[model samples]
Target: MDRLSRFARRIFALGAGSSMALVFLVIFVNSVRRYTIGKSIAWGEELPIYLTIYGVMFGIAYAYMTDSHIRFAVFLDMLEEKIKRFVLIACDLLTAATGVTLIFAGHAFAMRRGSVASSGLKSTGDWLAQITGIPWLEWVGKVGTWQYAIVLGGAMLAIAAILRLSERLSAPSKAKEPVAPLAAPAGKAST
Candidate 1:
């Protein structure tokens, strides 16, 4: 389990970091070209948008894996220990369910829209064709190619949620803080 978690952490971190780097690189290059030569790559706009989506998805999974995702700690703190445990477990289950839903929904959406191609990417294909013998552009010009990031993010989220659930189940409960005593039953003889 530890090894699996470590692997997932690495993958999520690398994916998010790489996506951000690529987006930055592409935008920088495009800006330089536009300013210096008064021309920018046709697909520059579209590529960065897709890469940003990928980066956000990976970053979300990475945040959840690191236990940094949002939570209502104030509400949770108000509950009894056992109820808190139950609520935590339930929350984990809910997160896992959401992830699974994303997987199926994303897959269906991608398949339904897979045939449509982006005009920018289609034009960019010509640029790539000059270098590669294979028709790689045709494969990736479709929106569905990048939409798979949704599915990938869903899978990572599910894995992280389940791992957290397991850890929660195995860990010992924390000691609750002592509650203050009542006001001596409204001053009963002061003793």
Candidate 2:
């Protein structure tokens, strides 16, 4: 399980990094073209938006897997150790629930948008088909394609949350230190 989680984390990182890199390159080249030749690639604007969405979605998963996401720990710190553990478990459950919600919402939205198409992406598909010599690639530009990122992100989040909850539950609880009196003994009182 540990190894699998590591592998998943790596995949998430790669997906996010690659998407960001591609988005940057496309936007840069398009900007250069627009400035130098007064023309922009048809897919430049559309492609970057989709890439950014994918990048952000994957990055969220990567963050969750790596325990890099932010948490407000001030209140948690005030709780007893055992209560803290339960609270953490509850938080994980909530996160998993949210992820599940996203999964359903994203799936429904993607399905509904399946028939909708983007002209810019169609042009992109045509260009890609010409360059790659794949005749069928011309139909690759569906608006619903990028919407699947929400599903992917949600799945990753739910899985990571479940794994974390399991690990937390299986781990041995820490022994709390015995509380000492606030006031020092007469012999040990401060001068």
Across 120-184, the per-residue lDDT of candidate 2 in tens digits comes to 79877777889999986765587877788899889888987887777778888866988985887
lDDT of 2 at 82: 93
lDDT of 1 by residue, 8-37 (tens): 888989999999999999999999999999
Off by over 4 Å in 2: 126-139, 178-191
Candidate 1's TM-score? 0.84
Q: What is the C-alpha lDDT of each candidate?
A: 0.85, 0.85
Which residue ranges in model 1 land beyond 4 Å of their true spot?
Answer: 125-137, 177-191
**Which residue pairs show backbone clashes in model 1?**
none
Worst ten in a row by lDDT for model 2: 114-123
- Which candidate comes out best when scored by lDDT? 2
> For model 1, what is the C-alpha lDDT against the true structure?
0.85
